[model samples]
Target: MSHVSVSADQAGQRVDNFLLARFRGLPRSRVYRLLRRGEVRVNGGRIGPEHRLQAGDRVRLPPVDLPPPRPPQQAPTRQLDELGACILYEDERLLVLDKPAGLACHGGSGIRYGAIEALRQLRPNQPFLELVHRLDRDTSGCLLIAKRRSTLRALHEQLRTGAVKKRYLALLTGQFAGRRQRVDAPLARYERGGERLVRVDAAGKPAATVFHARERYPQATLVEAELLSGRTHQIRVHAAHLGCPLAGDAKYGDPQAEARLGDIGLRRLFLHAAELEIAPLDGVGARHFSAPLPSALESVLIRLRQQTLTPSPP
Candidate 1:
């Protein structure tokens, strides 16, 4: 029973995000339910959840039950401070952080207090905050945040045009040949027993990743991967297809290598978003950000190197 007008600042946002942002305590499932039933309309016409809003458009919001917001449900101040300390670079238009592993990029999908939620809580005064792109929850490293919708759109355009680049470092189970190798395979996402997974399928969308072997061990190889075309699980799936699944990747991994690495220190997914490069947007100059490998991962490599140096039993 309420109507809202989309302003210039609100343009380019998905209707779902706009609704969730406006209704703090709104249940995501409830929002989707309303959207599916056409209860939520824009410009007097029904639209799906992914529909983007435009300036000067009128949206009709039907009445719905919403729980009162709770302070306990919010992220703790200590965690927020820790996330703040991870900031690698911040400008009027963009913010970059060294996102740690196990912390998701955003909330929902059974996740609570993700990076975006924590940032919004920490900087309550900031009007605009949106993810420029998303990294897997198990993957750690450089993440981008756009402070304005205009900046978000510009960066998205750049991504579509291949102007934005990201470098990922992954530890594969088997020896990877060649100094640099490119995997050009399509990928498709499917669900099995309620768990979502991706695989290389001939009928899927085109995907590509270029990998540079950085270091090699008797049983493993460290490689830097440059994403040529962004796709879900492109690096992991491609690495597996190359006969060297990533170490510690339970979903798509080599079990024997996992057992071997367990002796050293491969306890988690060995993928890291090491670098990100954004080409100049409008008048803004190009920018680059990097994050060193986490110390735990560093220790794994150090131990592996030592193992390789030791003479085999005679």
Candidate 2:
């Protein structure tokens, strides 16, 4: 028999999901088999797979044969140093970094190493580092890391209650008129050809975004997109629905728009996470963080202004 106690970071997760994470190599069906056979119990009583765990709860499991855990792989020193160079802020409980474009937040699905993996390698002694939220692999900006389970729980609550403000900068394919526009639409996620895709649908979860025009050029417009609700691909899908898809977004953007900016060096999705603000949950003042756009993205704008025949909008 084995016993475990749920900590703050482990709270609110389903029993089966928690077990799956705890025993990394365990198959999903095997986890449920344990639950069905009463081989797993919480507080000395049988619990269903969907039971939500709470902090400090005790979990008991029956002994079963399992394979030995794999040895940890050491991340390349160069990758670790590169990630360290992007650090924007760090403290006892948080680690914030200016994540570069084309780097996944965490490793899986054939990727050898990602931001979190490299960070782990850099701080091999630190035990509790975990991502507070996630960003797309191609999106660059202020990524948050929580060093303490309590801090992670607090930040997760902030995200749930709309107390966290996330702002992103994007270049739309064509002129986006008006000062700002709110896209109040629902979105649904579906898998096609092993790729995840999100689309606006009435039956899906509620998703909203507010787009504010920051600057306008003849061919494309630079806009600030404020997410009212964070759904999968919310900004990208909403932008496409408005007919102003993000430049270089091959998944949701127009191909012609991408070609139009190809000469200007628009090689990836023209989206950047510019800022993050979280209202203090424990009587402290709000915390704000910002990341500057990468040089490559900035060069695209410079080239656009110089080559495009149309002048900047007044």
Candidate 3:
């Protein structure tokens, strides 16, 4: 039997997930089997896989077969250089980066390495680093990394209580009628044809989004979106529900609109994480950060301006 005590860095995570991380080569099914068989115990009692671990809790594990350890994949030098350049800010307790689009926050599902992996390689001396939250792979913007366990916990609390504010910029097809609009809809995740998708459903979790029109083009409109309740694909689904799906959003977007926008240089999902605001975990005053739109997206806007004469609503 092996005994381990959960630390602040490991707290607040599901027991099963913790086990999977600890035993890298263990299959997920085998992990669940251990839980089902009561081979894994917490504080002298068997607990379900979904149980959230607490700091200093004792976990007991029974001996099990181990798989051959796979060699860690190293991040390429070019990728490391690119990630290093994307750094927006760094401090003792925080590391913020202007994450580029097409980069996943973490690696999995056949993806060899993502932003986190690259960072781990770039700063191997940093012993503790973890993602505070996740953005879609194609959503570029300010991403937060906590340098300390306490800082991570503090930020997670802020997220739970709705203290952290995240705003995004996106280009949507069709002209919006109002300067500002709000959508209150419930969102649910479902798998369709082996792909995950979110939709507005009455039985789903409550979600809300507020959108402010920023610019108007003949074929598309740029808008700023504030998330009231963070749900999977909340902004995208809400925007689509409003008859203004995100331009180039291959999943929930309009195909014809994307094709038209592609002719003007909108090649990727037209969503960017524009701003983030939150109080420091160290009880300091709030800090605000913003990431400007990438040049590719800007070029698309410039093209629209030159080709379309539509005037925006003042």
Candidate 4:
């Protein structure tokens, strides 16, 4: 049996919510199942799923042994340096990496392993490296990895309390109206067969993004985006909603315009998580980290700059 105690800060939260927050790898459905089975109790009394927890509540959790660990697969034969892994910053608690385009943040679907696995192999003793958050496979730039579970929990708390700031660099297909704009819209997920996508819907969770145009050209605009809420595909959907879909975003861009850009080097989505700022867990000042533009994206920008010098039709 596991004895769990609630703190004053965790008061008023549902029992299931508290369990979910405490256990990282456990699924929410399983948490409810344990509650339903009366495997969980509070202060020597069995509580229902709707029980509202109060400060100093002692929670009794049934002993739950985690499943056996899976055998580690053989490391891939690819050259580690060729993977383009670059370290932006590193400390005892965390490592900020510049994730390259075309690599998944973590394995899913048919892919077996990802950068996290490779990094683990590179530093086997430091087995606690874990992704704090995720970035899309095609999106390149600053990704955070926590060195220990305690640091991960602290970083997650900061994210929940709005103490962390994230910014992205995007190349859009058209010129935006002003230097800066904010998009406040809700996002909902839609399933099409086996595929899932997010769209702006009134009934969905509240999402907000702020965009600032750094440079404007006839064909594309370089914009910086700051996320106010961390929803799936929030920035992509919000930018697409403004009719300035990102260049090479096949999922949401204009097919005709994409075809026209076949001659250019705009082959993949031109979005990168360029910067991240996190308040220090020790109550020190804020810490900021940034990843330089990957060569692929930088080459595209160079071409765009040359295009700007060319004369356009009246």
Candidate 5:
């Protein structure tokens, strides 16, 4: 049996809880099995799973035999160029990668080799890097990744509890008369060309989004969006319902406007995950992550600004 002495900081937490906290990869069932077999002892005595640990308590642990590591998978030919890659923040538990436009978070449908798979190849030793949340393939900005299972669980719990804050920057194709507006619409799935799509339906699950116009251009408006409920394409569907579909949103916007926007470098949907705020577990502190507007979106903004300066004929 291996012995472990509890430190001051680890005191007050339960033995099973503390063991689970320290050894992230170990399953809870295994930990409890060790406790029941007297393989785990506290202060030279076998204790129950509910034993509260105290500072200076010496615990004995059984030798846990782990499986042999498997051979690493060969990565694809495409090497991630770090020069253009934006890293917003990183800690022992998490990494916030500023995902570029046109990169999928995970492989699906007919696409392969996504951001997470590429990152795995980039950092082979970190086999546990996992996506805490996802952004659409065309969306760009702050995307959180967890480095450990425990951290992933913690972050996911925070997301479920509505403790994490998410904000997006979008350009809509029409002038919004109101400065701030809230859309409380329910969304239901609809079928289009054999593909599933979400639409605002009164009988569907409730979804809400808050929009505030930041700047008004001659033909477009810059808006900040805050999502109260996370649903697939919530912001895009809601904005479309408000008669101001996002710029370059081909699937849900006016076809003529989409074609016009396409001529000006607004190729894909103009939605981005701009900022995220999450409270850290273990009482570390609150953390915030933000990514600058991607070059594609920034270029569109520049063109829009130039258009605003040109005088319109009465």
Candidate 6:
């Protein structure tokens, strides 16, 4: 049995991550099991895995196996270097990155390591580095990382209250009705064929997104999506509700359209986190960030433009 007072530096961390970090070799499954069984307590009360610790909170840990520390995992040299080069902006308090597609924000779920793990390896001495928000694995663009616990807490508050503005660019199919449109539908999640998916439902949490058409192609329309409420797969699900599923979206996309895109150099989801805006914090003014579309997606656009302009075979 052991009791530890959460320090200011340790505050705001979820119990699961705290346990994983504290016990070097502890398997994540074991950590959750302990939490589920009420073996871990906060100030004499059981807490869930997602419970954030606060300064001065007393946490009790039950007797558990603590294995010898495993060797520190070293990420691939290429991953480390790629993360370093993708930095759009960095300060003592935060890091803004133009994260490429196919890279997850955190490591897990068949991915041995992701951007967060690689960054930690690259800056081994940096005491605190945590993801402020998550972008889907196949979604590319501005992903935020906090350098301090205080920053992480503040940013999380901003996100929860919808103060931070996040916008994404995606290519949608079908005839978009107007130059601007808003999808105000709640979404619910379910599993099908062992894959998680979301659909609009009346009994789900409230969600909304406003989209502006950037341009239109022969078979698709490029649009910018402004998220009013952050929900799992909100934009993609909402776009589908509008009958304009995202191009190259395997889950809710048109198979024929996706097949056409697969021929035009669009190998991944045609989505990007194009912009982000954070309000003033701790006396600092608001900050904004933008990332240009990747060259691969851009190349597809070029080909689409040429196809649109060229004389069609009669």
Clashes of each: 1, 0, 0, 0, 0, 0
Instruction: Report the Cα lDDT for residue 272, model 1.
Output: 98
In model 4, which regions exceed 4 Å deviation?
Answer: 1-70, 74-79, 82-85, 310-314
lDDT of each: 0.89, 0.87, 0.90, 0.81, 0.81, 0.89
> Considering TM-score, which of the candidate structures 4 and 5 is the better prediction for this target?
4
Q: What value does the lDDT take at residue 3 in candidate 3?
A: 100
The local distance difference test score of model 4 is 0.81
For model 5, residues 1-314, the per-residue Cα lDDT tens digits are 67889887556667897777666547788989988988888888889888878889998877786546444444355446651256777778888899877888875465666788778877779868888888878888888888976687678778778888999999888767678999999999889899888999999999989998887787778889998878888999999999999887767887877777778788878898898998867578888878888788889888877878852321
Residue-level lDDT tens digits of model 6 in 14-95: 8898888877668889999999998889999989999999999998888887987545566889778888999999989998
- Candidate 5 CA-lDDT value: 0.81
- Deviating ranges (above 4 Å) for candidate 2: 1-3, 7-17, 27-41, 44-51, 60-68, 281-283, 308-314
lDDT tens digits by residue: candidate 3, 159-226: 88999999999998976767999999999999999999999999999999999998888767889999
Q: If scored against the real structure, what TM-score would every candidate get? A: 0.87, 0.89, 0.92, 0.80, 0.73, 0.89
Backbone clashes, candidate 4: 0
Candidate 6: Cα lDDT at 104? 82
lDDT of 4 by residue, 136-246 (tens): 888888888989766776787787788889999998776577888899999999987778889999999999999998877786788999999899888889999999888
Model 5, which residues run further than 4 Å from truth? 1-79, 310-314
Runs with alpha carbons beyond 4 Å of true place in candidate 1: 22-38, 46-50, 67-78, 310-314
Among all candidates shown, the one with the greatest lDDT = 3
**lDDT at residue 143 of model 1 (Cα atoms):** 95
lDDT of 1 by residue, 74-102 (tens): 88878888899899998788899899998
- Per-candidate RMSD, Å: 3.5, 2.8, 2.1, 4.6, 8.7, 3.4
lDDT of 2 by residue, 12-128 (tens): 877997898787868788999999999999999999998989999999978867778866666777777888899998888889989999999987677767888788888889998
Q: Output the lDDT of residue 78, model 3.
A: 86
